[model samples]
Target: MHRMLSYAKGLLWLALCALFFSFSLLLPASAAVEGGYTIDLTPLLDALMPSLLGGVSLLASMVLAWLLRLLARYTGVVLDEKHRKTLHEIVVSRLQQIVTDSYEGNRSAFRISTKSEVVAELAGYAARKAPGAIRHFKLDQNGLEEFVAGRVGAKTLARLKSSPKHAPARLPPKPAR
Candidate 1:
């Protein structure tokens, strides 16, 4: 839609320029002499055509350059978004793997490890695995730590809920009528 609007604007500008150029050609090229007026078509056509052509060419070039700039900017924004999304997915998958590995099926070990320790370990792993992504996304240490901590907290809660020890006990059967 934006591209279409740009093309439309360029066409509108060209049409306006063409209209102005044609009108300019129709204007009288006359000089006042003593008790008379002299019209010279040759000199008028020679001078006017070159300047008009130059003006139209300049306008066209400017419009083309503007359109090119817009296109480049749009492409850059699209690429940046794609890169950021890929980086996010990589980080999330790495974080999940680190959490699962640290679990090791031992509740005691999971409980003993501090949130900060887990974050540090995950951060190191992510840096090793996706250094370019971290830099491109501009993810700072604090942000990475917070993200790891949040995911870890959620995972811990989910593990606790799924564990048999935390599951609701079955109620005894109701007394016979």
Candidate 2:
């Protein structure tokens, strides 16, 4: 929008300059004769007007093309951002649902061996849910695994912290040798 405004200002300036130049050309010029001066510039102004208007028309067309290109690029960026945000929400929700269903009443531990299985299932689930986004965002197996593992670890830690049964135990005092 800001770019469009600047282009509009530039076009206004060009129009003003063209108007001033045409007015200046229309004013009569004085040429000295033997005993007097005569005013005449009709022929000169007639020849210049067509070429001047043509040049302005060409410049205006070029500016219009450039503005259209900028608008297309801006629209593409906004849509990509919207897709990315939607994909993130879908992945997070799916992860929570899978974790809840698989590990209910078993939050005491999230074993390292089972983490790979969970990640694999999550990748498949996401692919099924938003197939277009998976390709658009260029998500690979390694990236998906890392993302799932991180979220799972954080969730497990939060649950453990909140559970009284899993509270950290203090070590007893050591006896003097």
Candidate 3:
């Protein structure tokens, strides 16, 4: 549906452009003279046609590209939710791996695409491992690196090291009726 809409919009724009171009070509090739100033319509049209058409095409392409980007972002969010749900343990392990690698000066393990996701996952782990300590301080990339390396503070690190690796169980299912 979205692709069809985008294609329909493009076709509409093309039709409008064609109509304008044909209309322009139908105009009489007359020169207007006012005192010492003179303007030749043919020359003006010849100079402007390519530029105008190119500008219109560029505008249409930019709009289409923007629409595609929005659609991808929406779909990506839905897929990310499903991925997280189905692979919760794997995600936790990956988050830990990234954090550990980052602490060891290999920050490239969590590049731009997954930077925010890594941060969010690591924050969850921290919150679980140290219930209240992580909330007391801001944890940006650097802070997370420090926290992962037991450099944030001894108390927090102690709690984290002693805490169980597994996430706490969510609420149990209600009794089956």
Clashing pairs in 1: none
Candidate 3 Cα misplacement greater than 4 A, ranges: 1-24, 27-45, 77-177
Which prediction has the highest TM-score against the true structure?
A: 2
Tell me how far candidate 1 lies from the true structure as C-alpha RMSD in angstroms.
10.2
lDDT of 2 by residue, 1-177 (tens): 587668667777877887788676544332244438665666866887786677688667878887887897877876677767776777678766654533343445433235566667666677788778777778787876675566566565455335444335445799989
Better of 1 and 2 by lDDT: 2
In candidate 3, what are the lDDT values of residues 1-177, reduced to their tens digit? 688578768777876887787566554322223345544557766887896678678667867877887897877765555543433444356555754544444524543233344445555565566443434344464665444443223443344344434434345689999
The C-alpha TM-scores of every prediction are: 0.39, 0.41, 0.27
Relative to the true structure, candidate 1 reaches a TM of 0.39
Per-model C-alpha lDDT, please? 0.62, 0.64, 0.54
- Enumerate clash totals for all models, in the order shown: 0, 0, 0
Looking at model 3, residue 86 earns an lDDT score of: 36
Tell me which of candidates 2 and 3 scores higher on lDDT.
Answer: 2
**Sort order, lDDT high to low:** 2, 1, 3
